[model samples]
Target: MDRQFSDRVEAGRVLAAHLEHLKDRSDLLVLGLPRGGVPVAKEVASALGAPLDVLVVRKLGAPGQPELAIGAIASGGVQVLSRDLIEQLHVSASRLATEIEKQLKELDRRERQYRGDRPFPDLEGKTLLVIDDGLATGSTMEAAVRALRQHEPRAIIVAVPVAPSHVSSSLLSAADEFIAVERPQSFMAVGQFYRRFDQTSDEEVREILAAHTHSGE
Candidate 1:
């Protein structure tokens, strides 16, 4: 049976339930990949009673196919690329460089926009829950996990609302643990499982973070 969520909120709640054992852990911190991930992470953070923050990641889309991610870059100058995909796609060196530069700029912009002058939260020795709406190719989420590893967190749990079974399994090695609300066999896209999978705006991301930040303070 295919599981469908009314929206990210409902999906997040379902995902949070699976994480019940980790509820209220002192060292737990939740980081959502904006802007879609923020809403889902907000619900998870609320359900778990953990502080919430954003982890900005930009997909390094392939040449001539901007929606297809050949790699991804995250905060702290961390990047993960699929060389096999790039080679197969025959992405030119100059074009690849251009894509990286563009995404890096966007990544920096998002980090500043969502966070303003606030410094990124310290995660040393903490157990981080990194949330996203879903995973299609899993490149972006993989980049996020690799980047967060540099901060030396005790563990990283990658959680999402929906993803292909294989895609979720592939990320298992990147993250300490992986959680997904649904892994349907017929999955073609993340939005297919949601009744309302709207694009999350920058304003929405800021508002969610502001609410969490103030509540944390």
Candidate 2:
């Protein structure tokens, strides 16, 4: 697993180039999945001269295996679970419910913290580009697309810098367009593809959003 990107910023720039066709489109909106996706998305928004915002999504990790996502929850009460995984692991209903509740609370907190009094942007009949640093199981992005559908976006595009080949394929039908910079066959983890895959903090997400808002103003 060789590092394909120097950092998220560089990955965003590269992704922006791939998405050059969308530059300056009035109907285009770029929403990044925080907090890592926000930095990558900031670069995309700047490159395309498009409005930038955050789409808060939290992965529902399996109990005692925090890195393995059994599901994901997004804003607007959208919850998606990998039933097959749950069945395979034999996760108890009670345990799953508890995880969902915990994640929902975090989701609510993130929404309030990231957007504050700002209203969610209108997406009706618009082309939405949902971005992340990378895709692993694609569960989080799946939840995001499902939630955004309620807003009636004309099209949804999931863009990432790197993802496993199989994971990217699985997401193709979930979004109007699925774009991945590198779909390595020997994929290990999203972080393995980036030289600087540090944890993205809440303050970083807030600062990026604030800068975007100020620039728009």
Candidate 3:
């Protein structure tokens, strides 16, 4: 063990340990921000005995640096871009629009692949727990919260394994409750805390959802 845990499974176990209090909420729903968030959320849902679903979100990456998100787009055509980053990088409207269109296509493809004819669960008057592997710029998470708010969830709880303190602070108003196990002061990448931070595939996401749904039934 090189300090960090072995994988998302271990991370989820640790995450579940701290969330024992939520195990008994009657109307609780755990929604993972796929595709990386699904694995971790699976563990949390399993431990908490809560129904699990996914919230689709895509990062609008700056040209030449796909990992550097200039903004993020979520389901239902919701987007949140950093104005400062856009002005600083001199990103043009045409470029941002192009990126958003590209990511929206991706988001649609993923939604179709993962969901098929399965309907999204009703969020009205339900306690929603949004799970992600970690939080970085918080743009994607913010977009997700904004999108989810339209559905009128009783409350929105953001749960993650790791995040910077400032990012967590910024999300405090967006989410009804924020829970992060580690708020590292010197965080640079979300992968730093994971021993096996591998890319998650669409098939895996579907399989996890199917298996959990069947098992729960």
Candidate 1 on 41-101: residue-level lDDT in tens?
A: 9999999999999999888888788888888888666787789999999998999899999
Collision count for each candidate, in order = 0, 0, 0
Task: Name the regions of candidate 1 deviating beyond 4 angstroms.
Answer: 62-70, 81-96
Better model by lDDT: candidate 2 vs candidate 3: 2
Candidate 2 clashes: the total is 0
Task: Quantify all predictions' global Cα lDDT against the true fold.
Answer: 0.88, 0.88, 0.86
Off by over 4 Å in 3: 1-3, 59-72, 76-100
What's the TM-score of every candidate structure? 0.88, 0.86, 0.84
lDDT of prediction 2: 0.88
Question: What is the Å distance of residue 134 in model 1 from its true position?
Answer: 1.6
